[model samples]
Target chain A: MTPLLDIAELAKRFEVGNKRLLYAVDEVTFAIGRGETVGLVGESGCGKSTLVRLINRLLDPTSGSIRLAGTELADMRARAFAGNANRARIQMVFQDAGDSLNPRYTAADAIADPIRRLKKMSGASLKSRVEALADMTGLPRELLSRFPHQLSGGQKARVGIARAIAVEPELLILDEPTAALDVSVQVVILKLLQQLKRELGMSYLFVSHDLNVVRLLCDRVLVMYLGKIVESGPAAELFADPRHPYTRALISAIPQADPDKRVGRLRLSGEPRSPIDPDPTVCRFYGRCPRGEPRCSAEMPVLRTVASARQAACHFA
Target chain B: MTAVPALAVEDLSVEFRTRSGTVKVLDHVGFSVDKGETVALVGESGSGKSVTAFAVMGILDPAGRVTSGRALFGGADLLALSEHDLAEQRGRELSMIFQNPRTALNPIRKVGQQIADVLVRHGGATRPDAPRAAVEMLKRVRIPDPERRVEAYPFELSGGMCQRIMIAIALACRPALLIADEPTTGLDVTTQAVIMDLIGELAHESGMATIFITHDLALAAEYCDRIVVMHAGHIVEAAPARELFAHPRHPYSAKLLAATPGETVSLAELASIPGGLPDLRRPDLPACRYSDRCERRLDDCARPLPHRVIGERHTVSCWNPL
Candidate 1:
């Protein structure tokens, strides 16, 4: 079966003050099937944002290929891609769109912007479609006229989601969608997104730092470290027994409410190895890995198959 | 804890004179922190958790007034102290860590100088001696290259490093009580764990009472010994950490616990708390704030909020608690 979205050897880099090159995203590859939810989990400076931007075409990739339904996305000019025919096929919902939503625009107007720009629908149809999107996102029609200041956090989040899905995108890129919401409200939004995925048959690339939320929502998970895809596996399988050492530390750090379960400290200390002008010879997790050996510094470990449906970039795995 | 609590608040009511009207931000909010104990103030935004902390710290906003309450710290009512006396007591016996360390830290000043300022003012270090003492505090918080990082501005450091500086400044004088208001809100999960570990270690070493104000129930469960659930300026429930998570008595708490993402059976089991927070400005607000959102609300809930003691340390303000 053809994947809804596919990428190969994707990389993005930036020059820092003419002295060093920052590998915002190193060589990485992944895919998402139709209606599948794949989570991207990583810490700060791990290139999670860079990967999402590359896939969504918000930022141009330095090299490699991105195929959505077999159409090449990387070759188009950056400005041209914005107005490309395939522009409406992929959409993004950013974190804290509460602040991102234009203060001058009402909730309805915010949701209608994408529809007008992408779909070219106006007048009565646009108004009706805006209300429909609001309804689909669990936003009340009555609150449509309220400006951003007048709307609650959850309501603003709904407007953001409603806007992103207004054009009926096949794949939705959610960058920490529920990161700014309270737990109670977060659950509601997560459920809403899940239901919408099912109803609309849309694929999702859910990027978040919260592993528990990822475990609950994602079908598969991709773990990144210092601009590289360190591990990938089915969500339940990966979370239950993470193969990579970094994955283990990330999982151990989650603060669980269950008191009967006590987490042993797999504390990751010190900053991650510099992404700027990284040594191609050494493993990214070398300095911080608790299980680090002499061999780790001598060679960079590639993502080797660890299980039937899992892979991890670790020598032991 | 042998005689007087490290800090105690009673029947605290606070109001803000907003343009609309007097907003009752906190009502009958009370909690106590024993020596070396960590209490978590957990609730949604606008739940008055932060307001309770601000009221106790005697740092209420200009428009805000503490109408009725007694904040007893070291047997002295903090509410009754003059501004001068309150200022004197603030950093010496009581200190707080705000949510965003970047914004809280002075942008123009060197991070080292900021910590030194706290040391000189509260820790009784002389001006000439404060910088070295500040570096020692930084080392205690486990910052790498403390000497070099001390002179670095807050912006030069990463989010985690800035948070460490904030922790160092807050703990400079080893205050008896520490109020951390969403200290790790904007940090990554890994960094959040590290920061919490630092706070946990420092609090244990110094035997300081801590009131951790946050919206994350899971984080509170992991760090705090006691959990205080607030809603619309009222203490809905307070209980031992394990007991509360094992079996929450209040409807709001059960919903909050279920709503939190964990190794849950399924997302369908999760439920959002229905309805919005009661308008504090409204005179006709319900006595039980959760009643508007509670599925199991009873007529008795309308009379007046009833405080019930379930276990030795468990308390609830619901008429028909689960």
Candidate 2:
């Protein structure tokens, strides 16, 4: 069976001053299987947001193909793609629920706007559909008349989820949906996402900096650094024994809640190299890598099979 | 254990006179940090962790007043100090690292000048020599090429770099106590680990008492010597870091631990705490604020809460503990 989304050699570049091009996403290739949850983990400036925008058709990619269910989405201009039929097939739940929501729009109006625009429902049907969505997302119906300011953080998050799923998309892109919420509320929101996926039969591309949450929810995980994917594998195996040095450092940096489980961290030294006009021949993890070698600067390592279904972009892996 | 604590806050109660009503932000809240010890105040938003720190730092908004409290530090009652006296003691004996470094930092000034300004005012540095001291401070925080980066503005630096500058400014005078309120909230995990390690190392070397306020239970467990769990306006539990995680007596602490996602826990196994924080402005707030949401509440919980000494250093305020 064909995957829900297949991205091949997708790249986006912005021209900084002095004609220097900042390669935001560099030759990234990945796929999301049907009903699969794929997590994208990376530090800031690692191009995760750019990749999300490219796939969601908010930003046009400079190169490569984004095929959704065998339909090419990269060819259409982002402005024209708004009116395309595939727009409804892919939806995104933004990071901050409160900031993403317009304060003037009530929860009901926020949910109904998407449905009325995409599904083209009217008056009574729109109200009922909004009510059904509120019910589905476990948002209180009575609170739908209230504005974003009147709602709690969790309630705002529920409305955000409700709005994203109003048109019944096939693939949901959640960009740090729980980052702004409390831990208790985050658990509920995550579980709701899981249940909604199971019921709706949709694929999820979970983007977050929280590795623990990513490991809990994702089947496969991608670790990106400095505009390139350094590793990709099953979440459990990758986290347990990460192949890439960058991945290992990232996994070790997470502060475990259990004091007994605290281990000496693998610290990354120095800042990330400049993204503007980066050396195409050298590996991205060269200078800060704990096990840096001369060969790392001499050549770049492409993703290759390290295990049965695991891939790592390292010469030593 | 009999030695005077670096900072001791006793019976701290604060209220904010807002347009709606007077909101009790902190009710008889008290905690202390020993010399060279790191104590974390952990809680969700509106849990009064930051407010407690602000009360101790004398940085609360004008409308917010401390009704009753005695913050004893360095043979002085900080709460009763005059404004001029408190200002003198602020950066020299007490320092704070605010949550957002980007906003806390002066956008128009060079990062080096900001650090220099703190040193000149609090560290007794001369105006001419302050820049050199500022560069040394930057190097101490492990910022690469401090000489060149000193002239860069906050906007020119990344989030992690800006945080390092904030740390440099906070520790310039080597204050006796440091109140870091969610210092790593917006930073990446790797950056957070680095920043935390830096703070821990510096505190250990200088024997500076630290009150680290954060909502991340795991981070508190990893870095702090003791953990104080707060809910609404009260400190529900206080214990050694490892002891609290292993044997949490308070229902709120247990629920918060169970709610946090960990390496081994699955999504289905995670428990979400029911109900939100109670309205602080309510006139008839219960003596035990968590009793309404707690599953182990008893008739005794309606009365004044008891701070019980359950173990060596563990204190819980619940009437009925797990």
Candidate 3:
């Protein structure tokens, strides 16, 4: 069966001063099946956010194709894409509800704005649909009258989710949805997303730097570093046995609650190499990798199968 | 371990006078930190974690006031001190590392000058020694090329570097207590690990008592010697780090643990605490703020709350505590 979303050889580049070009996201390729939740994990400046923006068409990719339901959208003009019926089929829930939501808009108005703009619903029918969505997200009916400033963090997040789902999209992209919330509140939001996915049969592209959160929610995981995907695998398998040096370092860096279990940690040294006109032959993890060898600069390793259900872009792995 | 705590707060309360009404952000909140110890203040937003820090640091907003409390630091009543005394005591006796390093540091000022300002103002360094002392402080915080970087502005440095500058400023005077409010909130996890390690190492070298305020349970569990769980302005539970996770007594505390994404639980299995924190401005609130959300509510919960002593150091403020 064809995947619900298929991305092929996606790349985005920006020209900096001195005529140097920077590859923010190098050639990447991945696919998401219907009702599947694929997690993209990386540190800051690893191109995770850029990758998402490219997929969502918030920013156009420099090259490559973004196929949604076998429809190519990479090269489409912004205006033409907006009018496409497929626009409502893809929706995004931004990272922080507080930051993403406009302070001037009330909770009810925020949710209704998207539905009316995209679907052009109005009058009493729009009001009823907005109320139904509020009920679905477990938001208090009375809160529909409140502004963004009056709601709690969880309530604001509910409004964000409610607004995103009001159009009944086929795919939802969540960008660190719970990073701004406390653990207790984060749990409820995660559970709500899980239930919604089950009920609506919508696929998810969850982006986060947190390993623990990805472990709980994602079916598969993709680990990126320095604008490249270094590893991809089943979430459980990757957590159990991280083959890539970067993934190993990331997993070890997580501070375990059980102090006894936290042994020596592999602190990756040095900052990421400059992305501007990087050497094509050099591995991205060369300098910072503890297992770096002289051969690392000779040729860049590509992602290859290391286990039955896992792949790592490391020569040794 | 020391028999007595280095900093102790009892019956602490704070309120903010807003247009709507006086919002009681904190009520009867209390905790302590031993010298050379790390204590985490964990709670959601408006749960009074940061407000408690601000109150202790004498930095509460103009509209907010410490209504009642005793914060005893070296037998000094921090709450009752005058603004003049608090000013003198701030960086010398106690200091804080504010969250969001990007905005905390002055954008146009040289990083070195900023650090030097703290030394001259609080460390009593002579004019000639202040610059050298600032450079040395930067080196201590592990900033590379300290001399050149010191001349750069806050905008030139990375998030981690700016945070190191903040730490350099906070520790330049070697205060007895350090209050860090979400110090590593926005930085990458790896950077967070390094920043936390640096703070822990410095506190150990100076034997500085630390009050780490954050909402991330895993991070708090990783570093804190003790953990205090707050909800709706009240400290619902306090216990040793291990004991708190192993056997949480307060229903809120247990729910917080259950909510955390750990090695044991999948995201789907993690349960969020039901309902939201009670509105502090409400004229009528339950004796126990969590009573409405808690699944284990009891008949006695409606009455005045009770502090149940479960162990030597563990305490729970619920009538139906686990």
Candidate 4:
């Protein structure tokens, strides 16, 4: 069966000073099945956010294709895609709800903006739809008239989610939706997203650096570093036993809630190599990988099937 | 545990005078830290976690006033000291690591010079020796190529590196007390782990009493020896980390633990707290700040809350605890 969203060999590059090119996203390939949640986990500057932006058409890809339901979206430019017919098919809930929301707009108006732009609906119908969306997201309908400043963090997050789902999109891209919230509020938002995905039957692309949250929310997880997908596998299985060395290190870095289960962490000492004009032949995790071998630097490790339903970009794995 | 706690605070109340009325920011907030002990003050945004740190550090804003309280540091009272006396102790005897290093640091100055300023200002280092000492401090924080990175400005470094510099400056004087307010809030998990490791290491070497302020209970449970849970400017519970998580006494503490995104439970099973914190400015504020939203709240909760000692180190301020 065709995937809900399929991206192959997608790349986005930026030219830095001195004519050096920075590969923000390079040769990335992934697919999200209908009603599936795919997690993108990476360290800072690992190109996870760039991949999501490219999918959302917030950034245009320099190469490769993005197909939604087998429909080509890469040809459409970022600005042009806004008015394109597929605009409502893909929506993004930004990371910081407080800052992403317009302070001047009320909660009702914030949700209504997407519907207005995509559906071009106004008047009593629009108002009722906004209230309905709020209700679906477990937001108090009475607070819809209040501005963003008046809402609590969880309420603001609900407003953000309500806005993204206003158009009833098939694919939802959440960029660390609960990163700004407290633990008490984060679980609520996470639970709400899970329920929404089940009820709406929409595929989800969750971009976050938090492995624990991804473990709870995602069906499959992808680990990226320096513009490449290093590992991909079933969420629980992958975390239980990571194939790639980078994935192992990333997983070990998560502080376990249980003190007795203290992990003998796989510490990666040096910072990741510069992405600017990176050597195409060298593995991205070579310098930092504890089990680094000469073969890692001589040739890039491509993603190869490793287990029953998993892949890792490591020659040794 | 010792002759005296590294720092002891008692009946610390704070208020901010606003245009409309005086807002009570803290209501008799109190906690203690032992020398070489790490205690985390965990709470939501308006829980006054940072305010407690600011009050103890004597750095409250002009609009804010310490209505009542006593903060005993070593032998001296931190609240009784004048501004000038407090300044002497800030960088030397006690220091703080702010939330965002990018904003907390001086953007214009080179990262090395910033560290040198702290060392020379209050530490025993002389003006000429401060720069070299600063480089050594950077190396201690495990920043690679200290010599080259020393001259790099704050803007030239990444968020994690800037945070390392912040840690370096805070630990420069080998302070007796360290206050880290959300030190790893915006950082990546790996970087957060590294930064936390560095803080733990430095605190041990210097025997500094650390008050880690964060909203992340998982992190607090992992790193801190003791946990102090706050709500609406009041400390709801305080206990050893393992004891608190294993069996939370206060209703709010239990709710907070349930709300944490641990993999042990399904997403739907995880629950959120029922309601928001009570308005501090309300004329009829309840004595128990968490009573308004607590499921275990009883009529007795409306009366003045009393501290109930459950265990050796565990205490809860509630009429009906879990």
List, for all models, the DockQ compared with the true complex: 0.80, 0.85, 0.71, 0.75
What are the root-mean-square deviations of the candidates from the true structure over C-alphas? Answer: 1.3, 0.9, 2.0, 1.4
Against the hidden true structure, what lDDT does model 1 obtain?
0.91
lDDT of 3 by residue, A1-317 (tens): 88989999899898898989889999998899999999999888889999998888778888889999999989886567777777888899999999999899999999999888889999999999999999989999999999999998899999999999999988899999988887878888888899999999999999987889899899999999988999999999998888998998899878788988788677766678888888989999999899889889999999888988688999999
lDDT of 4 at B223: 91
Lowest lDDT block of 10, candidate 2 chain B: B1-10
Q: What's the distance in Å from true for residue A46, model 2? A: 0.4
lDDT of 4 by residue, B168-260 (tens): 999999999999999998898888988998899888887899999998888999899999999998898999998998899999999998888
- Model 4: which docking level applies? medium
Relative to the unseen true structure, what is the C-alpha lDDT of residue B50 in candidate 1, on a scale of 0 to 100?
A: 88
**What is the Cα-based lDDT of residue B183 in candidate 4?**
99
The pairs that clash in candidate 2 are: none
Better of 2 and 3 by lDDT: 2
Worst 10-residue lDDT window, candidate 4 chain B: B1-10
Candidate 4 global CA lDDT score: 0.91
> Poorest 10 consecutive residues of model 1 chain B by lDDT?
B1-10
Residue B168 in candidate 4 has what lDDT?
A: 94
Expressed as tens digits, the lDDT of each residue in A1-317 for candidate 4 is 99999999999999898988999998899899999999999988999888999999988999999999999999999999999879999999999999999999999989999899899999999999998999999999999999999998889999999999999999999999998988877888888898899899999999997888899999999999999999999999998889999898888888776866775777778788999999988998888889889998999999999998899999988
Better of 2 and 3 by TM-score: 2
| Per-residue accuracy of model 1 over B184-265 as CA lDDT, tens digit each | 9879888898999899999999899999999989899999999999999999999999899989999999988888887665
Worst 10 residues of 4 chain A by lDDT: A259-268
The local lDDT score (0 to 100) that residue A16 gets in candidate 4 is 91
TM-scores vs. true structure, each candidate? 0.98, 0.99, 0.95, 0.98
Residues A118-180, candidate 1: write the lDDT tens digits. Answer: 889999999999989988998889999999999888999999999999999999999999999
